[model samples]
Target: MLNIGVLVSGGGTNLQALIDAQKSGIIHSGRIVTVVSNKPGVYALTRAENAGIDAHVITKKECGSSDAFDAALCAYLQKMQVDVVVLAGFLAILGDSFLLVYKDRILNVHPSLIPSFCGDGFYGLKVHRAALDYGVKVTGATVHFVNEITDGGKIILQKAVDVLEEDTPETLQKRVMEEAEWKILPEAVELVCSGKVHV
Candidate 1:
């Protein structure tokens, strides 16, 4: 089985989805071995602990530089022999140094369809808000590889969710998470782990 190391920065809703998927045998090709958080004391860490997964914190402030943070994160993931890295609600921006080593091995789930309300300055509720502002009739989630460009890697899976007329960013965010992010994120993991998708 492949080892998956997840990176998180806040509430681990996506991580929880993966854990549930694993428990239900939706992801049998790989197992999540460790979870690293960029922010300490986030609920994501608690979720990791509850799932019996090893959890640790490595903040940019702690490392004192982007390069340092990347080095630290890469070192830890390498030490754990992680075959795949999943950025589940991970807010920290990874640098090229780290990206070079992991290359296509890193995967991330964006809240909105890529090339839309995505890229720098678009994350969390901001993505939903942008879609609403743009009056998009449909907004969804995307699972893609992590490259140097923001949300610019090859996409693996995407599931669209309707944009309700009476939706706030928060409401739309919840719906997208339930209808798209939670589903395809695990499916994408299965695809990557099972060798169905690759560079």
Candidate 2:
């Protein structure tokens, strides 16, 4: 079974989807060994705790530098023998040391179709707002291999949702998230677990 570590920074809706998929036998061959977060008091940690999974808060404030934080995070994942790292709303940009160590084993879920509304300072509601403002006809989500450059990874899977003429950012995000993230994230994680994903 693939032992996975999920990293999250907020509500962790995607993380919840992974847990649900595993429980429902859609993903029968893997387990979430740990859930790590950089922020404190996130509901994601609470969800992990309720599920009885090992959860950790590795706040950036506690570490001296990004390198040090990555080192500590890597050490923890190694201790858990994590086979894969899933970024579920994790906002921190991972350092090169962490990427080098994990390499092809790390995956990320982006809220928008990448190479468009993704990069520095683009995340969460901001991405959805951008898509709406730009009057794009279609915007969706992407699941990709994690690399050092922000969202600059090989795409594993993508699902598109139409940007309706009457859609506000919140409305568009809700619709896209339902069709894109709710399906794509778990599917991508399953692909990784089943060894179907290649770098």
Whole-model Cα lDDT of every candidate shown, in order:
0.95, 0.90
TM-score of each: 0.99, 0.97
Give one digit per residue, the lDDT tens place, for model 1 in 1-199: 8999999999999999999999999999999999999999999999999999999999999899999999999999999999999999999899999999998999999998887888999999899989999999999999999998999999999998999999999999999999999999999999999999998
Compared with the true structure, the alpha-carbon lDDT of candidate 1 equals 0.95
| Cα error of candidate 1 at position 180, Å | 0.4
RMSD of model 2 against the true structure: 1.0
Candidate 2 TM-score to native: 0.97
What TM-score quantifies how close candidate 1 is to the native fold? 0.99
Model 1 per-residue lDDT at 84: 96
Name the 10 consecutive residues with the lowest summed lDDT in model 2.
Answer: 21-30
lDDT of 2 by residue, 1-199 (tens): 9899999999888889888888887776679999999999999999999888999999778998898999999999999999899999898989999999999989998888888899889988899899988889989999999888899999999999988888987898788778999799889888888988778
RMSD of each: 0.6, 1.0
Instruction: Extract clashing residue pairs from model 2.
Output: none
